[model samples]
Target chain A: MKKMLLFVVLSMTIFMAACGSNDAEGSSEATETEDGKQIVTFWHAMGGASQEALDKIVASYNESQDEVEVRAEFQGTYDEALTKFHSVAGTDSAPTMIQVFEIGTMSMVNSGHIEPIQKFIDEDGYDMGHLEENIVNYYKIDDQFYSMPFNSSTPVMFYNKDAFEEAGLDPENPPQTFEEVEAASKAIVESNPEMKGFALQAYGWLFEQLLANQGALLLNEDNGRSGVATEIGFTEEQGKSIFEWVERMNTDGTFANYGTNGDNMLAGFLAEDVSMFLQSSANSRDLIDNAPFEVGVAFLPHPENVEREGVVIGGASLWMSEGKEEAEQKAAWDFMKYLQSPEIQAQWHTDTGYFAINPAAYEEELAVEMHEENPQLKVTVEQLQATNPSYATQGAVMDMIPEERKIIETALESVFNGGDVDTTYQTAIEQLNAAIETANKARGE
Target chain B: MTNMTAVITQEDQALFVRTKRKQRYKQFIKGILFLLPSIALFSVFLFYPLLRTIYLSFFLTDASGATTVFVGWDNFVTLFQSTIFQQSIKSTFLFVLYTVPLTIVISLFLAIIANEKLKGIGFFRTIFSSTMGISVAAASVFWLYLFHPTIGFLNIIMDTFGLEKVGWLTDPSWALIAVAVTTIWMNIGFTFLILLGGLQSIDKYLYESADVDGAGYFYKLRRITIPMLSPTLFFVVTVTIINAFQTFGQVDILTQGGPQNATNLMVYSIYREAFTNYQFGSASAQAIILFIIILLMTIIQFKLGERKVHYQ
Candidate 1:
């Protein structure tokens, strides 16, 4: 009897331990109102100053309203946050809103977990002209706004003014064309024996930017949207030209490839070891504060043969979570509008070095005043204004784009790591097309 | 009257036995009461999830997490046919190959050194064991930064020595080796402790007998030390192989299976498919294969161990 009792106690202890873990896993799924306020939670990956800015916005909204209170929560890195958001979405305890990266836009749009913000816009009668056309159109799915643009940034050239002067190059006038950039960088390298000529983001964003400027479409059939058949069109003549340029740069050691991890680029740039970098304009504020030397910001260099179109937005947007009540949706709508107000837009842009998507915000006297005080903000605006309605050339969109991106990135890595560019790119094109086909099928395209 | 009294006494004895049985039954019921919570937990958590994964493996789940078709073995067939999946398997085996032997050998060496009656042995043991407390993700991140080709600490040190920068994690050729080195470093302690325990368990008489036989150090090591350490070595190798095959954190955090999929392990591929691509069915099929591989490897290890281990 005592032995049986002991076995029972042991089993019970194991059961309780198991139960404890389950409770931890399942506890966050609870959906209950706190303090009689219809509390809605939001999960986001934005950290540092960007996150702090978002939190302040949320706090302001909470203080302004008594009915619907949004509880903002940080969920870690972008990928981790997206994973957790997807996991908890359908449960009774899912967040009412989530900040999803641009790569996840298509998936979220198709998942039906996100409510169309266009409905809120119509109901609230918000001015359509308040939003920048390119920005609004980018987030739309079949003429419905599925998300709100929050942190839109474009890639631009960041030069160290001190490095430029040290190399006896004009510190004020940065390179305006690819040919000039190459020549100037080579000169800089020769002039200063210690520093590197150029380095870009590890993912080949610089290459893409160059291609975009040269009227090269990354994907066929209007970038795989609008019911057009798709193709991996980046391996065409235009792409080859860019690839050849990279090869020449690498071979000549004019441009040193950073580490496979992006740290090499970031660390080199921050330490003033590299003369020029092609990084997101969102890094403007951080660069200014952290850079050891005076920084010079400029528009991304265009190819001499073609007009400079513009850069694709690099950051995330606020997506409205699905399965929420009308009241919660209304609250979200109000918060989004509050975020898009001229004052908030100006502040966000000033603080984070992100471009304000609201034209009204840009035209605001306060924004102009701020831009006058710091001319670096004008560079991103100028870049955005230079953009054309070339959707195919702008940015490619696809279902399961992140997967296709991984394949292409792998191909890039191979080529950059001394593998044959043509063969590797050809292989990547084939693999990417297969992934695209599968994704399109999944999307019921 | 005398017969009736004898029958009554028997009946009383039977009644007493029945009362004792009831008391025992009550105790048994009390035991079951204690077990009820645990049984409820196991049924709800482990059993339910295992059954659910099996069920979900046969279905095509949509982005909305809705399942559609009952395509039994279709996912597995597709997985087997894909060159990428096959390559992942090959790479996973390679990772295990590099990590398992190196980790076991290194750890055993450390264990022997630690077992020696040398000064500061306790400090070395503590330092080695302390690494197990560090999170794999954190350690991988640190290693990734250290292996960075341009700004990495390794590169800086190499530059100081006038040596060219080595692509520790970037170059395809050296990526797996770099990851293996990191894994071996991180995991050596646990294996060391296990081997140390086995070493301590050896009968001192055997070594004394070897001394009597005038056996040299190498002879004693080959015959007594290794032979006696077989049981622990077998256990460590089996567990190490299992872990090496399941390597994902290092690849994911350090290299992200990059420089052209040089470090793409099976588990990482499975995770990418399941979580990133949301290909739950295919990922499950991969996981099922992994389970089988591990099971077979462990069984083979045990079989081999039975022959090699010197029980005496």
Candidate 2:
């Protein structure tokens, strides 16, 4: 019995030792050679096709310069990457640079752990004239860029051309306003009783975009840019109209409620269960490739009475971490600058359907070829260019944006379930404001 | 001569006492040495985190998990007052109610059927036990495909039966039931295996005696099988209840506590608080409350169930 006990104890110790060996090794120290070359780590949330493009760009940059050897790592999705960044912010394991999504911009700015890209731009006397004005406006705070916009996209309407033709609607003339969308949807439903006219995931981003298209603020204090917003502005007339329209659509059987799953909604559209849908421009490639019928692309519909304002960007940006060695920071900036170059941006745009942040990328041969092959790719650029840069169009900046988005999503779900719109929005707004206040208190802001 | 004998007896007694104490000391050292690793591991992974969670529940924390200020009982107070948290508790209990009894009934039925002496019983047993081999994530994904509203197998079957297609995931009324169905399916393999073991271990004599008396199958089952299986049923019930309370993956993957928070289980609420909202203090408080609730539930189950378990 004693021998058996001894053996069991030894085996357990060995098992624990084996388990201990699997922990990740500590971060490597940043070292600079006499030639001014430094090693930097760049963490990003790009995955799948986007990840391939990011890898290619990183590889090319590594081959192009001897000054910086960037080791790019894919760190899951944007939320996951930000969570990891928060966990390791003060630790040595924190990446020298990280990509943060648009919603996380406020959090990153308030984090105080980042070196603003504006500082590097000013130090290098780099001209920002080539960058798209509207895209750059998103990451800018108080006329200074907090991070560099990498891949930017705006929401647009995608329709099935075959469905439109079959429904006897003009394929070339898609719905340009909410009223027109309703009319066209009615016609489609009457003609084809089997298919729904439209479908969209109950995503908060779409609601935000719709509000922006109507030139309305989603949060107070000029969309939380001039001051910290204490309340949501989504209880305004435009917000109510948007909700009423969705509720009406659902009631009329003109809208397919796909819940909040974007992929499932996309599948519904691709399978032609719905004639039209609204999704990010980044899905252009997928629709063009995988869609069974010709995919028609158009600007997102606005309310008939309200003039259309341009949509806010939905992708993420690259932010450099603070407290790193100056050489490493500079190396990270060089990679960011490399990413924004016209050739690389064009390739990125072509590879992933994300709109290139550099307007000059449109002039690149690859981008021109891509547009020639599929003109829908050019519509996103035109739509962005037409956007009037204003506080509302810049999108909301709030530390509690994620929570607020969740609240809006919940409100939408409730409204869909025949809940009173005014009551739902009021309750949601109150809850959101309370949450914001609590977060501010927690942060001691 | 008497004094010499007394001194000899005292010396012998002293020797015996010393040897007994030495043996006990050796045994104590050996036992402690054997348990040291487990104690260390438990302290590091379990006990320390539990203590820290309790400590954190009283303080407000920043996004990076740094404590900013001491809030005393504010976190717990806010959680108790929040309607969402209350709804989550109700939803969790509803899920437990939906899954536990159904899982017990279905698995018990299968176990009895598979317990019969029939040809290819092993194949049928393997078929019923296959889900245990599937991971929660894989199973949830499979269920997601099967539960898709428009192009799913379930809806297709409903269509074939001339039934209206119910939005299994989208509809608020059906979402929780859909998730419960997936969970019940996932749990049956485990519960079935345990019950089958219990079924097989019953002495053949009792059933043989019942057969000689011309007792019906139902009579024999009620009199012999159920009583004999009571202990195993008790264990399965306890385990299933605990597992049901901690259901997170299916709700997260399927509904994300949505369709108006109809499926927001308590554990999912804790996850959202800590990870999504970065409210560690509130999350820790919720976790402690959940721990208490589970503890109370298990205690009640044991109290009510142990007496009914026939150990013979």
Candidate 3:
């Protein structure tokens, strides 16, 4: 009986420990070396080639400094990194400074756990004017700089020039309208029986880009720039046009559904399973190096009825923690300025396909040589410059945009699976409105 | 003389009752002493968090998981009406049905086959249980390559055979099956090991006695082998069911509950609600519902299935 009792106690303890850990707290002190230099932990979401480039930059920054050392920790994707930030926000476990995506701008501001970059800019007399105008427009809202813009990208359509020549279509001028893209897809299919013509990944970012290209807003109240958005902002025609375009290609037997996985879609294009896709220009370097065939980059397509607008900026920026040592914040500010220098920005722009936020980086030899070798790299910049400065092009600002994105992705997947477009669109609108209302209510206090 | 005798008997009865009460109180104190440590741990970890979840379910929460507004029963009511939540419930049940029985039967079959007195049987046993050591994340990522749409070997095989290529993880009907198949493959290793241990423990004397009585192999297996393994089977069934209901890792790594929410099991939905959407109130409500479900399932199994479980 005594042995049995001991066994029971052991098993109960094991079960108790199986339950998840409470967020650990109690340490609010910052770390300092014996040499009296502060350590600034910088969390980021850049992976692959960009990660390597960032590490090199940090190494250089540390080598050049003596008062503070910055540690760059690569957190997972943007969504995952943001989720982790929220769990440890306002605690000592949080990073001294972190990178946040463009869509998370509003949420990070509302989180009340970050010190606005405007404070440091004012004290340091930093000139935010040297950055690219289009990139600056997306980050600067309500006449204030909440974060320092780092990497920025826009959506552009990639086509197979070899496939175009084979299909008897013009290789120099790619399709610039949705109707022309549909026609091109049909022609490509006619020429190659084994390969599909087009693939639109069931991704939310591409869906948002398509809407912006049609000059449609994502939320009401001036895309939430003027005030908090209350409901859906785009009209029925603007939203349904995107659905109908995909449906037509799908009907023509020219559409390939890669369903929510971008890597798979990219792989399909490289394998010659699909001939065309719309992807971020951030992938330009990798795609050009990997594709076995000639690749061409063009502006994002719009519907034939509406005049062509431009794409929204898709990337991340750096923001400092709300309460940290003044010395640490100053060190981070210095690092941010270092990151925007011509040499570092040129290296970043060349290594990663994210266009340089610092325009002066374009004049650097590294950037100039990369553009000359891969001329397709210039198309993303041209597209960004062409965008009319409006609320729609500036992109929506909301705390619930991530939730809104999931809703849109689900609807797109349904349409790709042959569900009725009208029903899918209707369901998406209802869910999005409900999410916005709930978000507002959560912030009611 | 009669009254004097009656009073003496009543006094003796009163004395006996007093001693019995004292003995009962002493035993109760001893029992409490044995249970003190377990009770302390349970209160700190299990009971506190469970009660906290229940409290959070009745109020809305902000992004940092703080309670912002009070709305009684609203979270539960909204979950019931929400189509996405409804789809998640249906898919979870479907996934459980697809994975549980196949895992048990396949493992049991492997155990029986490897129980023979053949040469090098131990090698086969080790091979059968090899998947037990593979972590869930590694296993899911490996399966992801096999299910890749364009480059996966499975689709290539289908193409060679001239069959219509199936979207293993992209189609609504196939994504759950793909995940279920991956789960069954992962589970067979541990389940096979347990069942094989039970098989090895069964007494050989009974089989010899059956052979002396001219019993056939099928008859002996039907009559003797099954009844002896009942306890082990009962345990494996309960654990597998609970594990199936709590599946989150493979789904997160493989699908993230995509392809029109066809693979959005309850746990993944709760994760998305709480972490990604930052809707803690509704997430807590879902967690509570999942807990009640697993609780009722275990209770029902013990009540109905325990009778047939034979123990030595």
Could you report the DockQ of all the candidates, in the order they appear?
Answer: 0.36, 0.49, 0.54
- Each candidate: RMSD: 6.1, 4.1, 3.5
TM-score attained by model 2: 0.90
How accurate locally is residue B88 in candidate 1, as Cα lDDT from 0 to 100? 83
True contacts kept of 1: 0.56
Best by lDDT: 3
The TM-score that candidate 1 achieves is: 0.87
- Candidate 2 structure quality by residue, lDDT tens digits, A117-218: 999999999988788888767777888988988988889999988889988899998999988888889889998887898876778889899999999998
Q: Candidate 2 — what's its lDDT?
A: 0.87
Any residue pairs clashing in model 1, and if so which? none
Every candidate's lDDT:
0.76, 0.87, 0.90
Cα lDDT tens digits, model 3, B1-312, are 999989998998898788888888877866886787777778888999999999999988888889999999999999999999999999999999999999999999999999998999999999999999999999999998899887888999999999988888888889999999999999999999999999899999999999999999889878988889889989999999999999999999888899999999999999999988989999999999999999999999999989999998
Fnat for candidate 3 (0 to 1):
0.69
Across A231-262, the per-residue lDDT of candidate 3 in tens digits comes to 98999999999999999888888988888888
lDDT of 2 by residue, B1-312 (tens): 999999999999999999999999988978987787788889989999999999999987877777888899999889988888898999899999999999999999999999999999999999999999999989998999898888889999998999998888888889999999999999999999999999999999988989999999999889999999999999999999999999999988898888888888999988888877888889999999999999999999888899999998
Where model 1 places Cα greater than 4 Å from the true spot, the runs are A1-37, A63-69, A204-211, A233-235, A363-370, A443-445, B1-60, B68-83, B118-120
TM-score of chain B of each: 0.82, 0.89, 0.96
